[model samples]
Target: MKPQSMLFTIYGEYVRHYGGEIWVGSLTRLMGEFGLSEQAVRAAISRMLKQGWLVSRKVGNRGYYAMSPRGQKRLDEAAARIYRQDSQVWNGTWCMVSYNIPEERRQLRDQLRKELSWMGFGMLSTSTWISPNDLADRVREITVTYEITDYVEIFNCQHLGWSHPGDLVEKCWNIDEMNQAYQEFIEIYRPQYEDILQKIQNGQEIPDNYCFVEKTKLVHEYRKFLFIDPDFPKELLPDVWLAADADQLFQDYYTLLNPCANRFFDSVYEPCPLVEANEVNS
Candidate 1:
């Protein structure tokens, strides 16, 4: 895994739980478990700081890092989606976003498109994006974040046209591709899950560090779906969706590994001190 991406996994899976902060030394040591050099970890941290995903503080001679508010918001959203169960019932309303950004602001337009995609919006046309979820508030946040409120408009409406909703869905996303990805995930991890379960049943002692590594890699792999899966509601999904199966497998594997993984993490984690507001500023 790339150092920066690994750091994000560590922060999201481990550091956020223990006061949402970690000493730079502790972070470097944890990164070493994944064969990342201290120099690489430091460089990744610097990049995250520059991108406003991380904030740094100093207490005496030691430096610590924590998620910035923006980062916290993003991670919180991701965690919710990552651990979410099967799709909820859809109300048959589609949230549509239409933008008319000027040619002069092509960069902002491109960024807006990326943001929309990341939020599970699929491009229906050149300037129109749609989702089955109610994302008006999220769209508002994106518009405000990108300073493109004047160029963007959001609507919650039903599709009453010639094409079926399923057809629209097919046009918007590659369901076959996503299903194959889930199948591959199942193929890769189901064996690992079965092996670990057999070992536990056989009274074999799995090392805490081993569990930690397994759990981290498991979550890291599962988290990839956030990029590719739009997580459409049950009403809009294909008849033979594999994402539900993948979700169940992930939950089972994660539950099996969580205790030992947390034990190993707690052994090495060094939480930041709770300083007074004024003291922190100083």
Candidate 2:
């Protein structure tokens, strides 16, 4: 429960915001806003306890509950794994391709593109794509997993209408450097993340008013969790990244987020290169 201790306001909007202590009275007030009765809130709290997600103590007329050690440990693992989101390297080519995706699968197409951006793939020209990770490998994994073969032919260019990067590592690695700039965020937020792990498991939908602020912080907070090494680099990346296979990494990232959101994009789309930046710079 250490990730987000400084900012109670962060989850205050998500869960019933409580003062240091939570009694039936406090939970009652908070739940009342949601039309939840005190008994209902108490039952939920007890359910959290049975799940080993929280530990509660009694202080006179009130009961105070917080994340149990086990709950905290679970969140810690999630935070660590979040940083290691992608386990592969990028190739020089951005790995852009086009496909005649079925019209009915429109939702899947958009979800695909959005997840790609989250994974750091950038759009070059029109639909032309570029990313630190190898596009060839990503496509291979997707084709095999989804069992669609038509998309296989699109990325293969006769004379390079589109191309990889001079050095994909350099561009993507810069983001890691930017992540290190936020040490304060890590320290303050880890506890909060731990504390919320229990609440997240409570099965209560996020209250409506809490959506914007809470999600923003979660995105940013979770961003911290996804940073493998905030200190990576900005100047130059390893030459080996050019040779790494991206297919598997893409599959893994795709799988990780698939449970949360659907893939999206218009078509197995391709955009003309804005300016095929010089052939794979080292």
Candidates in order have lDDT scores of: 0.90, 0.41
Residues 175-242, candidate 2: write the lDDT tens digits.
34443434445445445544444565686444433433333344444444233332222223444331
How far off is residue 282 in model 2, in Å? 53
Please, what are the lDDT tens digits per residue for candidate 1 over residues 26-123?
Answer: 99988888888999999999999999999998886789999999999888988989988656679899999999999999999999888888888888
Q: Which stretches in model 2 have alpha-carbon errors above 4 Å?
A: 1-94, 100-102, 135-138, 152-220, 224-282
Instruction: Identify the candidate with maximal lDDT.
Output: 1
| Pairs clashing within candidate 1 | none
Give me candidate 1's TM-score against the actual structure.
0.96
- List ranges where model 1 is wrong by over 4 Å: 274-282
Residue 119 alpha-carbon offset, candidate 2, angstroms? 2.9
